[model samples]
Target: MLLGYLLEIVKDRDKAEEHLVSIFETIPQHIDRITGDGVNTWCELQRLARTYLAGTMYADTTSEAKFPNTANKFSALMNDEQHAVFCSIYYYGKTTAQLAQELGKTEDLIRKALREAFAIIRKAS
Candidate 1:
């Protein structure tokens, strides 16, 4: 699922597969921190994938291209808060803590917004 999602953004099969492999390799180190009591493992994995891809996707800072264009129909599906959370984390590559600081909100609230954004994206799909 993460590979498929990466494929859509990166638009390269080899790179996507490489990224998927990298994600798997790094998962073990993060497993303890990412998965805690009552924390949905799947959602945490998705969040990790998104964070990794945000770094990878924006590596070429000189490029004007972006993953989730505002004009895209999928972007239109998100409400204001969802879009803000999604764009900041995904497009701008901001972490939840950074977003919380910048937006004057709690880290928990940023996480909640991110989760809601993912829920909206899932519903759209």
Candidate 2:
């Protein structure tokens, strides 16, 4: 499922698989933290994957090179703010608290945005 999400962002099967590998590669180092009491394991893993993918997005050195095929069907359904929150969390690995501070909104509002964004994705899918 996570790979499916990444595929939509990168629009490259090989790169998406590579990103999946990168996420799994950190499992040994992050196992304790991810499996800590009260921690949501899946969410932690998703955050790790998103952070890794964000690095790729930011590090794409060719400024003139466009990211081709970026808008898959589901992504097209997202509004600007929904896209912003979704990308910040799922692509940029930002936490709700971090996004709240950055966007000058309450954490609750950030979370609500994320929830709504996910709902949009779900409906589109």
Best-fitting candidate, scored by TM-score: 2
Model 1: clashing residue pairs?
none
Please identify model 1 stretches exceeding 4 Å from their true place: 54-65, 69-74, 78-85, 95-125
Q: Tens digit of lDDT per residue, candidate 2, span 35-83?
A: 9999998888877776676667543422223323345675568776676
lDDT for predicted candidate 2 compared with the true structure: 0.71
Superposition TM-score, candidate 1 onto the true structure: 0.55
Per-residue lDDT tens digits for candidate 1, residues 1-125, read 77766665677789889988988898998988678898888777867777787676444332334544445566677777667777766654677887788778999998998888888778878
lDDT of 1 at 35: 80
Each model's TM-score? 0.55, 0.60
CA error at residue 59 for candidate 1, angstroms: 4.4
